[model samples]
Target: MSTSTMNPETADRSRRALAAEQAASLAATNDWAHVDKDRVHRDWHELYGEIAAAITAGAQPRDEAVQELVDRHYAIASRFYAPSRDAYLGMALLYAEDDAMRDWHNSYHPDMVEFLGAAMMRYAETRL
Candidate 1:
């Protein structure tokens, strides 16, 4: 078996790329009216728990794990029905102010805010 060591920079870039891809996928999907919000929230909590456990188990690095969490969070949020562009934008704006969002942004080595914002803007454009 061969093992490779990833430098911090490469790992950071990979995590950001993953987040971007996830955001784009979420944006591209057209259906949302049938999503169950409560179920999504519960799933998010479960995913977060899994990530935390993975971190504790050394299965993944914290940065990568947190990026996954953010990706899942956005994917779930993207499934919600927003009646108008204003409503969608309002949710994004509210996300910007959310404590968990801020914590995720702070935890990443790269500029997660910029990356996530770009993805979110693309999501908005797809809706328009």
Candidate 2:
């Protein structure tokens, strides 16, 4: 409760989280138009957790369950990124090569990003 007892790192993280939530709301209100930022983020978070679990369980990129999760992932992604082969392919490559994106994905699990990248490319190849 007191500043002396509070962990600075935990307090900083809480502050950053609140700031991010406010920023998301402001973006949606100012320019996002019809997009529901909260809903999209919540759904994406759920899907990412599930996808990470599947990958940790040793589900291959082309596994039936993994494919289904990847499809759901793409649908969510398409809400922000226009649904198309190029967009999906770009996202796949981004996940694979972008340092910031890789760090975010790796925060979920060590291999989650690579697994999602593979599934993204596979989905693009087969569905797009």
Candidate 3:
């Protein structure tokens, strides 16, 4: 549950694995065209970790700091496809409900999937 104390090597491995997995998933969905897989992986790797840390620090979904992070997340996602408010909220639902996606997010923090889903939904409601 405490990601702050997660070993650097292990974290690096996790990030690399998630990045590759995400890139492959995007490619499979035909959404990787013109998308820099490496960059996408890197950005997501950093962003996910940062969001995990913020959540661990007790930032709520509607908190300013958490919202800022979600902004970055939205921007990164927009590179692949523009999302309407409903679509973004739907993504939050997918992250929380999809076993694979939930497992992937929980790899960073036990509460990652729930926290991220809430944050994304809040972002969609307020900003998207």
lDDT of 2 by residue, 43-101 (tens): 97888888878877889887778888888887876565444565455565556566898
Error of 1 at 56 (Å): 20
Candidate with the greatest TM-score versus the true structure? 3
lDDT of 1 at 90: 38
Q: What is the lDDT of every predicted structure here?
A: 0.47, 0.67, 0.74
**Total clashing pairs for each candidate:** 0, 0, 0
Q: Which residue pairs collide, candidate 2? A: none
Report the candidate with higher TM-score, 1 versus 3.
3
Q: Please provide TM-scores, in order, for all candidate models, with all chains considered together.
A: 0.35, 0.71, 0.74
Instruction: Please provide, for model 3 over 1-128, each residue's C-alpha lDDT reduced to its tens digit, 9 standing for 90 to 100.
Output: 22233355644554554455556667776866778879988998899999989978888878989989999988988777666665565566556656898898899889988787777766866886
Q: Which of 1 and 3 is the better model by lDDT?
A: 3
What is the Cα-based TM-score of model 1? 0.35
Error in Å for residue 96 of model 3: 1.1
lDDT (C-alpha) at residue 62 in model 3: 81
- Per-residue accuracy of model 1 over 70-118 as CA lDDT, tens digit each: 4565566656533233333334443355678756643542334434443
Better of 1 and 2 by lDDT: 2
Between candidates 1 and 2, the TM-score winner: 2
Best by lDDT: 3
